[model samples]
Target: MLSSLTPIVCGIASLGLDHVKLLGNTIEQIAWQKAGIFKHNVPAIT
Candidate 1:
């Protein structure tokens, strides 16, 4: 699971994988969920 990915770069690629699902199924929600890994003041790339 990418739950351990701490670099905090969010993408929409995996959102289509059957094992992963985004309720809103929108790029925005996927990015938002992926950004959950963000650390204080740390820069992230989407």
Candidate 2:
């Protein structure tokens, strides 16, 4: 998941690299995966 909670646990900004393998070689694919973290009515940063 691409939750802000991830960075909170790691103490570092998320660069979306961890899903590199899972996302294959497409920016669209990565974005689709990251979008899963967006919660309805909750604000997201970057």
Candidate 3:
């Protein structure tokens, strides 16, 4: 699952309650989850 995505640049197309089921509760939680895509020392563009 994108294991080579070292310098992950997730230019999120959009965000909404559509994935509420998968994201669990709270938007902050969802953001935190998505943010896990980042690398330990690498930088994220967006």
Name the top lDDT candidate: 3
Name the candidate, 2 or 3, with the larger lDDT value. Answer: 3
Which candidate wins on TM-score? 3
For TM-score, candidate 1 versus 3, the one ahead is: 3
In model 1, which residue pairs have backbone atoms overlapping below 3 Å?
A: none
Which 10-residue window of candidate 1 scores lowest in summed lDDT? 10-19
Please list the residue runs of candidate 2 whose C-alpha ends up more than 4 Å from where it truly belongs after superposition.
1-18
> 1-46, model 3: which lDDT tens digit per residue?
4577455453443455667789857777777777776666555655
Local accuracy of candidate 2 as per-residue lDDT tens digits, 1-46: 6665643321123546566788645766777766776666556677
The TM-score between candidate 1 and the true structure equals: 0.40
Model 3 sits at a Cα RMSD from the real structure of 4.6
Local error of candidate 2 at 10, Å?
15
How much is the lDDT of residue 10 in candidate 1?
A: 36
Steric clashes per prediction: 0, 0, 0
The alpha-carbon RMSD values of the candidates against the true structure, listed in the order shown, are 7.2, 7.6, 4.6
